[model samples]
Target: MTQITAAMVKELRERTGQGMMDCKKALNAAGGDIEKAIDDMRAAGSIKAAKKAGNIAAEGAIAVKVADDNKAAVIVEVNSQTDFLALQDDFKGFVSDSLEKAFAAGYTDAAPLIADQESAREALVAKCGENVNIRRLARVEGDVIGAYLHGHRIGVVVTLKGGTVELARDIAMHVAASNPQFLAPSEVSEEAVAKEKEIFMALNAEKIAGKPENIVENMVKGRINKFLSEASLVEQPFVKDPEIKVGDLAKKAGAEVISFVRFEVGEGIERAEVDFASEVAAQLEASKK
Candidate 1:
């Protein structure tokens, strides 16, 4: 058997970020073959990733890539089990690469983009020692496309018939900030409207008590209209200029919001609550074992 030197153990530790003892063991296990040691380490990392696959990875970032001509763009979300992992340069770089690939492929649906990224994603998962997911992606194209990123947490893409980048960006930023549910009141589903009406009526039953049935009906209608106004993007008060409605702002800019998509990292994922002290103690106990 080849002897494992201190230099070999140090090199393996530096390459894999594994503990000194772990690196030495892997090096010895590979019989002093550095390349084989790396492969073994990676395999171990893959095992850890598999064990972590079910962990909630609700913390992550969004990456947006726009074409040079501003007529098309793509946004992708990469999720990590922890915010600390999400903030790493390597994780961010992976997300950026995924965005560029999605933009280049011009995929309207996320399925093809995800399928193309599987191998790279698995490698990333192993490297990060966590389960990483290319959670979702969206592509938008129009005569004019604008993209906005609010830090790494939120991303917005807007498609317009005709608009300056500034106008589109403003709209996109509004979308990121306001989280509008629909582009227009008409886009609000009938089922949603019905649900909101039922809720409003239930909540304000006492206020309409003893009133005429016609008057109560009008009150419910008014409340439903108000709900739509608040939920619809076009009717929302502009985030930059609250005096004007978003629709009016678009009209004044000689453009209209054709379409927009907003993505906020971890918007729907259920995050697990972890007790840090218990976790560290558990790790210490495991090491002793």
Candidate 2:
């Protein structure tokens, strides 16, 4: 019998980029032999799966699933390298399965859900012949939940203490369109306000150079308020009815917006630009050699 050590597992994980438990199990199965563990892991496709980790998977769909009771909803973004793969039925199925599993298990974060679907994810990657990644996940559970998915590209979930499904869905749709950064004006951070103010002041420095200090202060204050109105969900006008603020609409409906989250596929990822003809030519040239 071989005694497996944490140090051995760490080394194997570092070399292979596989999960800690998977490396540990491999190490234990190989009698604490790191090389044999590596071989066995590769034979099991774990190494091949891990190798796909470096590929850029920035294009995919946003999947939103609500619990049967409608009290909870989960949104997940699963990424692939190209839209072609993203639109595939198999890829869509994986995203749906991942969201369902997360919703059923009440997962609020991506880490646990990713771990839970590790084998399935690996299998999907192999089947797709491309890197498939569960990029982000968010779940909201509340007294009432409203979810809206826009063309499978953007998803919004809203939670309220007291609200009709219509109100909730309306708020979610507004969130999808407005893309507010804060739930309310009060939720806007002082640091963010200061940063925006600084930029505004710098840009208008010459215009305000000779103005009275009080007047300049008022100008800055007005600009900041305008910025807050645009960035705060409650302060923004409702998308359906532009005359009323979202806060007023919520209040009229006897509901308070608890929290909301919006997800857009590949929001922050920088995708690589590859020249396909050149890539094919290079592959052909390499084959001749």
Candidate 3:
């Protein structure tokens, strides 16, 4: 039997982009022969899977898992290269399994959970012939937690200090729909307000020009106030009951919103634009050669 050293594992990981444990296992199986380990990993589709890592996986699902006792909930976003693959049972199953593991471990950061699921993710990538990624995870915990999923594309988790699960769920649903940026006016940062003010002034520069200074200041303040009301979750009108605000609704329920996490599929990923017809033509041209 040959011994595998840390340097061997590190070399394998660097060469293949595989997890440390996987590299160690492969090295051990290959009798400490780095070349043999590489060959075996390539044959097992691990290398092929890693090669697909560069593909942008901006399409996928958001999964939410709430604890049995309703004290905590986890929301995760997993991505695939295309929506077609994302909708497949295999990819959905991976997302579900990943969310369960994160929730079970009470993982606030996605790194460890992602590491734990590396093998499964690589397998899915190899099988599906696309890039798959466990993009992010968010955990919310409080006296009461409520979670809502909107057609697997959007998920929201809400934490409340003193509220019924039903109320919390309602708020979560609202969040999934409204996608507010801040929990309240207090949570809105001064920088954000300043940015908004700058944009508002620039857009209305002509109208505010030559106006009285106090009047202009009043106009800017009013616009900033409106911006805050729109951007803050508590100030938004309840989706179910347009007559009432979310803050008022929570206050009526004797519940205070602690925090909320809302995730929408593919929110921030920059995807490559492919010309399908040209791609097909190129493929056909290559085939002729």
The top-ranked prediction according to lDDT is 3
Residue 167 of model 1 has an lDDT of 88
Better model by TM-score: candidate 1 vs candidate 3: 3
Candidate 3, lDDT over the whole model: 0.89
- Give the clashing residue pairs of candidate 3, or none: none
Question: lDDT of all the models against the reference?
Answer: 0.84, 0.88, 0.89
Cα-based TM-score, every candidate: 0.79, 0.79, 0.82
Q: Which regions in candidate 1 have their CA more than 4 angstroms from the true location?
A: 1-49, 275-289
TM-score of 1: 0.79
* Tens-place lDDT digits, model 2, residues 161-246: 89788899999999999999999989899999999999999999999999999999999999999999999999999999999999
Look at candidate 1 and tell me the lDDT of residue 154: 97
Candidate 3 residue-wise lDDT, 1-289, digit = tens: 9889898888788767899999999999999987678768979877854445346888999998888899988899998888899889999899989988898888997999989999898788767878889999988888999989999799999999898999999999999999999999999888999999999999999999999999999999999999999999999999999999999999999988889999999998888888999999999998997
For model 1, how does the per-residue alpha-carbon lDDT over 163-274 read when each residue is reduced to its tens digit?
6888888899999999999999999999999999889889998898999999998998999889998999999999989999998998888888899999999998877887
- Between candidates 1 and 2, which one is better according to lDDT? 2
Residue 195 of candidate 1: its Cα lDDT?
97
Mark the regions of model 2 whose C-alpha exceeds 4 Å error after superposition: 1-46, 50-54, 273-289
